[model samples]
Target chain A: MTSSDALAGHTFEELSDYLDRDRTPADPSIEGSPECQTALNGMQRLRSVHRDLLLKDAQRESEREDSWVSSILQHISLEARAGRDIPISHSSPTARLSVTEGAVRGILRAAGDSVPNIIVGRCHLDGDVTEPGAPITVRVDATVLEGEIIASLADQLREALYAALRQHTELAVEAIDITIRDLYQPFVPPAKASSDE
Target chain B: MSDAPSPDPVSTDPGTSSTLPDRLDKVVLAVPGVDELYSAAPLVAAVVKTVIATTVEAVTGEQKSNSSVSVDEKKAGLEIAVKIGVNAPYTAIDVSRRVHDAITDQLEQNGNPDVAEIAVSVARID
Candidate 1:
């Protein structure tokens, strides 16, 4: 295959798609070409940026929200699976109410976030979420704002999270355990502003 | 075809109601960690409205629809939904919960019942 011909038909985007699917139905000509292999390598490197999962980490070092945060948010799922149905008191025996695991997770996140300077990270409901009244553990990792008292923040987060869960969900939470994952730096004014004339 | 009045451009903010939507709008916008509130309009109109609202708010201390409210004539209630852009430092769910509580409180305080449902969509994180 000529150097240009190797990548002529399939765009880099197409080849990346092909690579993602294990290059199924491989075209012999592209596979055999050194030039094609080089282009594929370049495409792989580009994909690695997203693969790295450049999360927001809520860095407010600027006026606008960071561009990376917007990108990450676009890919996040809002309709996370709601767990099995938990029954509610209905006059009609057939009437039932249920909340999903996703909904429960939403509650947990909300509760944790309610606490000042606390942003919840990964949240897990670590037991049989499907079984009603089953004792399930809630575990979450959170980031705290720098300079905040850790003990006080934890206490506040615990209280808010508990209240939110109680008000919203029927889950018999066995325990809510929060692990402090990271501390974010507070926004600092520019040196130009701070400099005494 | 079911006979239905082309429901007045029933925005969550119809702007017809004097205090309820206006009061709720004030309370929602007042919440901390709330970066933005949503409005409905064509691209050009929304932009124009935003410009005007921001300008007026600066001078009059009265804000326009960051959120809106509408009533369903058939149903015995009103449904309110608004898109909010909030801080990433806080959780969207928490912000929504806060906003929900505030709106509910205002609606009840105003003696308005049939506030059937309120949905706070996190349109962006700032």
Candidate 2:
């Protein structure tokens, strides 16, 4: 498997297929590897957010560009690899504590997703993240649900991300730059809506 | 720092009760924010080890322990490594620290082997 498609030797397609199977008859290889698990978590969350829209989009494939979703998937795959080890300070000389870059990125996405009406896209941690006091800048792209004021939503997302980073990582966050990439309307499964009606 | 021989270095038998790596794995999982334990070794190495272990198990009818924690006995002291997944609402930073402390405390209980290093990394956050 090529590096772009795989995490820890398991391809992203394989991981997605595992999820599609509802993770039944669990694969030890995927379960044993942290990078694969990290990627799976990201893909699972993305699938959950896009479930209805995915169904709709599938039926109308040509109506809109699916590039955004593809971009997010690519980012998730890239970010899930165990990158640098961000050291955690400890008094004891023997204690070598750290949080992985993958884990930090995962939490950053989760924090951004926590803001209602927004789905976090690509997350980038700039600067020397391996260094404890380095000035790190968090740049993230997000898609806001239609109807919410973009400025307010961006502010909310930025704050949520900042708080999560502060709580989970000791990075010297210089700033959080949020880009409003697109707007998506919530898709209510037509079948469900018709049944309700 | 007791100059004791390394206690249960790479306990390969999962059936062996209370192996050092097994005990450490349990302790890490029990930590509040720890969602899952993953192999501290790199992915390719872990896969190869698993394959070899399975073959060994099939041939000898022995259930080899593939514990995620790695423990090494060094001239300096005991070296332990662990990777874990953190549950949301519980930050990875705090969870990793907790795991480190827990491992240290466990080792202390087991004759206080001088710890040269206890490397704990949070691999995922859910």
Candidate 3:
């Protein structure tokens, strides 16, 4: 560091971690620092948002259709947006076999998310998704739960995606490129063995 | 008209006005090609639906639908606006028409007539 990087030699996470250890007897260093105060405020906002989400989850879970309700509204909205029309083999001019880029994206995202402990950070259908019979590449940056081997997890995700595409879409999936963006651990992972192998 | 406080139009009594958004939220959510709800705030729910739900979806990025549903009670009728995220390959006009029908039919079923107009805004394609 630079002055912009830290508040008197402490990062935001450091300040937050310090408070996390104890919230009752406030730490003088953090309380006295403006940057720490700002970080605390940010954490407070995040906590409130998290609480709100839990409440919403409760409401949604109480009714089985609450999740469906979310999907339907999103479907309607997505069906209306403009993008390249991925063609499917349709005989009639009036009849169209086309999927929206957004729809493809949504499908890919869902598939990625379907894998246990997988969350997609970024997704793209690289290549003209609208072109039927054209080889298309799907790229996704994803985060996986820690302690799981990355290669195995990625392979599983890839298989799931390929299966979903085969079932739900007409696009020719040439490749699915998964980049492991981060390791997600709700808590810290155990340190690796100190073997020299 | 069966003036039973107009089915709690924009007030405390839980009836048509209170549940219209909830009804819309269900039906509209069932429509295909949806991604998220737009502009709905979190923790604000009905017995006073539309306003809170529609507004809050915009606030919290978590558990949001690509479509937003709003019901405004007016002297003329119920003014409804839905902001939606559409699938790029689909036609906005067709999808919006479907959304309009869904909202209208829902309102009518909830004992609400006199729908002033439904304004469908295409917020984005996600």
What DockQ, on C-alphas, does every prediction get?
0.02, 0.72, 0.06
Ten-residue region with minimum lDDT total, candidate 1 chain B? B65-74
lDDT of each: 0.53, 0.81, 0.54
Largest lDDT belongs to which candidate? Answer: 2
lDDT of 3 at B44: 24
Per residue, candidate 3 scores C-alpha lDDT tens digits across A67-166 of 4223322232232222465654433222233444544555555556567666554556778776677888988777666788889889998998787567
What lDDT, from 0 to 1, does candidate 1 have? 0.53
The candidates score, on chain A by TM-score, as follows: 0.56, 0.89, 0.53
Instruction: Find the candidate with the highest TM-score and give its number.
Output: 2
Q: Per-residue CA lDDT of candidate 2, range B1-126, in tens?
A: 979665554443345555788788899899999988888887778878888889999999876777789998888978899988888788767788889889988887666777789999887878
lDDT of 2 at B83: 86
Ranking by TM-score: 2, 1, 3
- DockQ order, best first, reads 2, 3, 1
> How would you encode candidate 2's per-residue C-alpha lDDT over A1-197 as one tens digit per residue?
37655776677677878989998889888887777777887888878867776566556766757756666776887788888998888778888888888888888887776777888888888999888899999999998889989999999998998998888888899999999898877887555455555
Write down the TM-score of every candidate.
0.38, 0.87, 0.37
Q: Which pairs, if any, clash in model 1?
A: A82-A100, A82-A101, A83-A100, A83-A101, B12-B68, B12-B69, B13-B68, B13-B69
Query: Residue-wise lDDT of candidate 3 within B29-120, one digit each (tens)?
Result: 66665443453322123113444445676687433232236667787777766555556344444555566667667666666667665665
Question: For candidate 2 chain B, which ten residues in a row score worst on lDDT?
Answer: B6-15
